[model samples]
Target: MFRFLRSLVLPEAACEEANNSSRYENLFKKLDLNEDGRVDIAELHAGLKALGIPLGKDAEEKIFKTGDSNKDGQLDFEEFMQYLKDHEKKMKLAFKSLDKNNDGKIEASEIVQSLKILGINISEQQAEKILKSIDADGTMSVDWNEWRDHFLFNPATDIEEIIRYWKHSTVLDIGDSLTIPDEFTEEEKKSGQWWRQLLSGGVAGAVSRTGTAPLDRLKVMMQVHSSKSNKMNISSGLKQMVKEGGVRSLWRGNGVNVIKIAPETAIKFWAYEQYKKIFANEDGKIGTIERFVSGSLAGATAQTSIYPMEVLKTRLAVGKTGQYSGMFDCAKKIFKREGLKAFYKGYVPNILGIIPYAGIDLAVYEALKTAWLDHYASDSANPGVFVLLGCGTVSSTCGQLASYPLALIRTRMQAQALLEGAPQLNMVGLFQRIIANEGILGLYRGIGPNFMKVLPAVSISYVVYEKMKQNLGLA
Candidate 1:
């Protein structure tokens, strides 16, 4: 009431203070494109676009109506202030609504009920996970202070900083599995700080791959031998591998796997950035379709550049110890015995597989993130760390599932023996042969071990990359 009275009176002190706040003054000037010091509907849309709020016409009309009081069809300085105040009040009311029974604290059930009001149906466990994040006391509840501190004290409310952050990525960026969370200055990048970032990513990748090497080798073994001779369970696969060479055999191909991480990451990340620029609008906004296209192309480029290493890796994974001593030995033998075509035996299937994998992974991640934001973003600007991990895991698993058969085929074609009179198989021929010989299930050979590694691989890779960035003072 007092605010209303003050606005009516148009106090000189408050007006002067607001005018002096430079940040708001600049925003108002930008939005007042006509130099009339008032923001019209078109100008408001322009400003919102610049601020990275990608709302449709209906949402724009709803937002415009809130600030254009007295049906002026435009927002003056006082009206803009009123809009900000009203938004703040709405946030407060939202918090209070969650803190039902006037308890000044929000519990998991309250959160669940609040989301239900928004037509968001989530399990109690999911609700509790959300609550526990903001529940600073570990009491499974958040008091008023916790709520205010967690939600209201955002640096992004400053508008300028928020615009910068939003410009980075409106939706989450699905980086290569080895991505580090860091930003570099132009000068730092010119000085090759990116090399350090790439090295950090390589180190993280090596650690993760080495840590999960056994499961990976197991996956390869299953993919190659699951349907041939005797069915290879994880136990029998391990026993066969150990019997052939020893525990060291499990890491046979890991050298190439670890080595390829650096270039693949560097190329994919660099190509993705370039491709995003090619796809971006004048305002630098990329739609989901553009993202998928750019991501697919980037992935294809990287994979093509390093595919020979992929052939080498598969060969080593299945090679008996005496067959080839090391990476160079394996490459030399494949080139000499089978010719250069051996390196690209399954190139067609590999390319087809990667496009869908990259597209589906990015699409699923964006969908999940958008859903979470639409339904549960009232109390926070960013989703929790666990939410990110869960989204990545599920999205990656879905992508892998979609592309697994092609992947299995590619690996088989890579590791196939070049024997006299053996049939040369293209993708269709291989698919027909596998189905005819081993049934359709043969195409899904190693999916069990592949899936077993997905969650842990994503979790460990992300956690380690984040930690490395933090340690390097880049996060």
Candidate 2:
């Protein structure tokens, strides 16, 4: 872990290779688009675009002022390099603080407590930001290499600083105030069309489902297998499944899971984006509170649409008595026998828990990313493996904390079908059933293992996905 963290704080030979290449010198050549040795607003924005960083008007002015050491409203090679180096230093500091435990690494639990102590309360957007940053492999954690590449060494820090510097300059230019259009232009709206949103959502869902199926299956087994019964642990359950059937038994209801994942992921990302846009400033910047609101909204929306399917998936995965044939069969049977209300058996818990789950997931993602970009100004990719692992661990821990209760409730509701003439357990009914039979503690069953299972799954998934996206230039 310390090695991983170390990587995030340093840079590779190739990354700094740009220095030998006189990358900044080349950038100045490009920015002098008119060969006039001076940059106007258009020229500055074009220069930013050349570097793959688009800036709004306010951000543009700040960059021009900061990089234009001559006060001539233009950037020279020397000035730009200076700006890049300063930006890199700040990013290093943020990542250093993120690795606050001094254990040479970061974990989800560590991040959560750290944020709480830092008085940096998180919201969903912030969580997503953190997750997306550290989740280089998209498994949601920073492996050593990923932590090094992205979190420890990012190009965006320089890019962002340039923009912020310009924004401040622009504000000073226009009556000491920064102005942004209240709504997206027609072109911007077109860029964010519904189809694109749908595609992103679907992809996220598929990714998450594909990554989490094995763990999800194990979790359900742990939940449904009666403690008094012979099956008391993951190993016993695995042994029983393999003994009775093949290894395929472990994937029992994965079919339903795959189908459900696309919509689930789609809804989650879509809702999150919309919520973030709503609560953020016109310029699309967000604070901790805004991030939380967006994340919670996204979580709630996704859970509401897909939770019933989650229940069905769990039912089909468990109860090997040949009760259900497939996802559709399970759904059909549930609807026919228990009525539509049965689909939402754990709606209350599921919906409420989703708020925190989504919120923390997205917020942590953003925070980690911001921290990464701050530290590594030379590399375009985020912190490498170690950073990714740290971010992932932190994100999953928070998600588990906020969602555990709901998970337990949902499990009980779904498990009702495992018994003969499963009870008509709604949210209240399930609560009563658990409390009456096993006392309040029953609601927290398997929490320890659940955390262990979910945190790693989430961390790894985010980290892996991020790495893939960055390689594709998506991040």
The candidate that achieves the highest lDDT relative to the unseen native structure: 1
RMSD of 1: 14.2
User: Tens-digit lDDT track for model 1 on 255-333?
Assistant: 9988887788778778877887898788565554665677678778888899999999898998887888899999999
TM-score of each: 0.64, 0.54
lDDT agreement of model 1 with the native: 0.67
| Maximum-TM-score candidate | 1
Report, for every candidate in turn, its global Cα lDDT versus the true structure.
Answer: 0.67, 0.55
The C-alpha RMSD in Å for every predicted model, in order, reads 14.2, 14.6
Kindly list the per-residue Cα lDDT of model 2 for residues 253-299, writing each as its tens digit.
Answer: 76776676556555665676687678867655665566556656665
- In model 2, the runs with Cα more than 4 Å from the true position are 1-212, 228-231, 280-286, 355-385, 439-441, 452-467, 470-475
Q: Indicate the worst ten consecutive residues by lDDT in candidate 1.
A: 163-172
- Error in Å for residue 53 of model 1: 24
